[model samples]
Target chain A: MKRIALLGMPNTGKSTLFNRISGASARVGNWPGITVDLMSAKILMGGHIAELIDLPGIYDLHGFSDDEQVVRHFLANNALDLVIILLNSAQIDRQLSLVLQIKKLNLPCVLALNMSDEAKRAGITIDAHSLEQALQMPVIEISAKYGDGLPKALQAASNILNQVQQKPSPNTIRQLLEEDNQIEHEMERLIQQHVQIPTSLSNNATDTLDKILLHKWLGLPLFFLAMFLLFQFIFTAGKPLQDGLAWALDWLRTDVLEIAFASTPAWFHGLMLDGIYNGIATVAAFVPIIVLFFLVMAIVEDSGYLSRAAFLMDALMAKMGLDGRGFVMMLMGFGCNVPALMGTRVMRSRAMRLLTMLVIPFSLCSARLQVFIFMIAALFTAQQAPLILFGLYLISFITMFMTALLFQRQYKSVEPFILELPPYRLPTAKQILLRGWLEVKHFLNRATKFIVIGVVLVWLMTNFPSNVAPASAGTYAGQVGLLFAPILDPIGINQELAIALIFGFVAKEIVVGALAVIYGMQGDALMAQMATQIDWVQAISFMLFTLIYTPCLSTIATLNSESKSSAFMWLSIAWSLGLAWLVSFVFYQSARMLGF
Target chain B: MQLLSQLESGQSGIILAIEAEESLFHRLSALGFRVGKPLSLIRRANFNGPLHVRLGSTDIVLRIADAMRIQVNTR
Candidate 1:
């Protein structure tokens, strides 16, 4: 078996290429010393399997960041048979430094200059043969997104394995003096001799787009409008599909659920209808909207436009000690904070990485959207759902920004956002749609595991009158909530409802699942009644607090794993809890004073 | 004149010395940015955009003041 690792600086289409070769069969497991998992994919190159390891994007092996260390270890440990370096053609200078570092490892290597298609469009030209000779290695230029020349690149690696060539040079420290100067001088000479970098493209089409998109005077406004449109699409255009899913779930409850319980005893019947059936139904409502939102995000990221987004927003981030990497994580945060927090591996500075992780929990994840939309939809017409949803997102963005300012004030230093903005390509439809489907499938599977258990437990709580609570307290559900009513009184939520939301701490979706058990009889009426029990301040407080709270246990585990710092993990939990409490307390108290 | 980050985004400018000043443009220069090149600040995000710039045929996002430090002529 050949162990091959693909390494690159950020935005060289490394991950996209990995997806192409590995499909979705990659095994994701955490590596020691890093917060995120080291992802490996098995491609049967010749009946003998070749394991392709996708390391996080790293600029230099010397950096202290989690990603740099992983790549550094793999090289020093002789972890892989060979290393394949992906270089961004347009930004070859910055990328070549890493290639030089790897070459110093004495490993048999292949250079795949990805995004040649973009290179061509950008008016840059390279002499492939001369370039290969100058670097004293095999190099193939290909666009991972468009699938151009990828085969030949893979073929080169295959040739090395087929030859059983001289064992690759084991990476060790002899401290070669000429390494940096040699590559830089050679790359410059090579570019001078072969590559023709266009001095015009940036001023042409991209400039026109950036002029409107990144306008100093108009940039923020345009960015906001674009973001507004995206959010609107999630709630407005997404509603019909959401309602359709809800309708089908309701049908299942009335039709199949009732049929399954026809002759069953009271408790079994309750478990089936209110427990299992209800859990499935609540999860089902999100399938449509979540799929829509992720699909859009994937398409944007795949096409390389997200870099432009990072471009448009890089300045203000530096003020807070964040970089383009933090921006990218924040984008991913919109999908889910766990992965975004994990994705912070791209940020090399520990202090910046920690701050980014701390702030991400405050960004709204999609799971929270379902609850926000459903409740707000109940309070107003469907037209109002989008407006209200936008308001929540607005609140989230504002809160995140404010929190970051506070974080920045208490900080020392942060790494600059060093990002390569690749030329834009039309994202591959097959890949984008497939990735979106895979995410939805993953979420649904998790729903099956935890949601089913929580639903059944909540049903039993409501069913048992002579159960855990005092016998005179009626059902176990009411009695349990009664014991904790005073604790939630400040938020203005009654005991029963407050108890259910507290259950959400385990997983946000369970809040809806538990509420389903409590309010199944009322169906649509539950929203109205839920409102009466909690005033506007309390409801908004709930939304804000939940937004700022610790991400589910899964993210906490990822936080612990990725940063390799238990302190960062515990601090995330503690600080978020503290911030949420302070913010919600102010909101709740101030609202009552204003008499709403 | 030394800090690229001082330049506001959306300003079309010229690149000055990088890396020598420990600026993000220097990092980009290490990434592939060169001296004596035209640079422009595209747009900056509240927190995520490290630094957005338009140079030559490609767009680059660097840490802070990368473009700001590069002396440029803005019309």
Candidate 2:
């Protein structure tokens, strides 16, 4: 089997090409000991099985950017049969510098000019034959988006692989570390000789779009509107799917499964229905929202507005020691922290990524909002509920920013801001759907086990010894809650709420359900009983704790996987737990002192 | 020579020298910033933020602080 790696600057349609060739068989998994995963697929090329690896888009192989380092590391470690260097046909003047740098490595390579159709639309043309002669490598002009010239490109790669020359040594990469200022001059000369770009080309589409999109006054508002519509679409479209899944699961557990398991032991039935089935249901309910969120996000990212959004928000985000892209991820966190955390890949700087990860958990994701909404409705009047919810949002933002400001210094590295604004192009439906499906698949593969284990563990804790009532004072979960009751007393979280917090760690959406079960009541009855148990101040404190405590198990698993560091994951958990306790303690103590 | 950040919107300039650390200099050069290459400031973001710059049809967004490190000749 031969190996081929797709290398290119960003926005070069590398992923599109990989997806087009690999189709639905692409597999994304982390290489052993690598910090992040690269998408790879096994495809038959020219009657031979070949492994195609799609690397992260990099600006320069010799540069110190995180993505660059990743690419360089991958090249040094893996002996590839061919490196297909993809370049944007319309932006070849600048992109060719990377090609030259890679050429100096003396590796077997081919040059692929992608987006040739867009280049033709823009009145740009490249002399592929002359360029190939000059570069002494096969040059393939292909439009990955439109399926143009891809077969020829793959055939050229396969031809080179058939030769099977000796793999280049790692020392060639070290040789590229030396700066070569002459590559730019050579690139200019090559373009001047072979590339025919019309002088003073007018009727520019990107410029006209950028004029309005990046307008000094209108840019920020347009960005917010785009974000607003995106989230609104995700939720509006996803809500019905989520509700349908929830309804089906509930019906299955109660009506269908209850009848089927009538003859089984009561303990076995409860464990199967309440423990395993509930765990699977909780993870399944999130599928629609996660898939929809990434689908729209892919469209935005591919359309090139995502970088513009970053450009517009940079100055404001700079104060918190974050890149503008971090702001977008934080907003996405409000919907679901798991996807938002995965979305941090948009930011290339390691420091920005880590800092963003620290802050996103405090975004008051919708799961936590469910808990707040329930608590607010049960405790406060209709008018007061909205204002109190608004207050919680304010606290969320404050805590997010505070977290960023606090951790920025420790993670500070000299990461300069340099972002590319690719020309706008309508993303293909196939590409968007592929991205959404792959992301959902990845989420399911990586996060489902953690979520199921967490939910089942909580169930076990609340229903152990097989003698006592589930979630009752005699159970293991109840005993543990009592153990922490005194420690939590300062924040007004009693033993019952303490037990709910354990279930909340699995998922915040379960907090209300857990409370209802622990109290052995349902719906309105549980709300009335809770209204009599905890007052307004205690309710507010509990809400605060819910807002800032440890993220759900899936998010924790995502953090561990995304960061590829258990230490950072543990730190994130401890930090959020500490912050939640401090905030709730302060608020509860001050309110008591003020006679609220 | 004036800093790239000092160039007015819509004004084009020739790159002179980039006063930055090795990493940033390498990054800028790879993005087509050379001693004689031409680039234009498309726009400045609000509140003294990043500048939208175009170099040979490639548009880049750089913070004002980083933009200050790139020297260019307006003429």
Q: Candidate 1, which segments miss by more than 4 Å at Cα?
A: A1-203, A249-254, A261-273, A276-286, A323-395, A406-415, A441-451, A454-480, A503-578, A587-596, B1-30, B34-57, B65-75
Query: Which runs of model 2 end up more than 4 angstroms from their true locations?
Result: A1-203, A259-261
Clashes of each: 30, 0
Quality of candidate 1's docking, in CAPRI categories?
A: acceptable
TM-scores, each model vs. reference:
0.53, 0.70
- Per lDDT, the best of the predicted structures is 2
Candidate 2 lDDT tens digits, A1-596:
88888999998998998899999999987764258889999999877899999999998876657888788778766767788999999888779998887887788888999988888986688999999999988999998899889889888988888885776765555445433424645676897688744223222687888889899998889889989999999889998999998999999888999998889998788778777888888778878988998898888888888899989999989998998888999999999998899999887888789989989999999899999989988888998988998999999999999999899898774778898888887776777888889988988888788878777888889899679888887789889978888779999998888888888988998899899989999888899999999999999999999999986888898898889899999999999999999999999999999998
Question: Ten-residue segment with the worst summed lDDT in candidate 1 chain A?
Answer: A169-178
lDDT of model 1 at residue A400?
A: 73
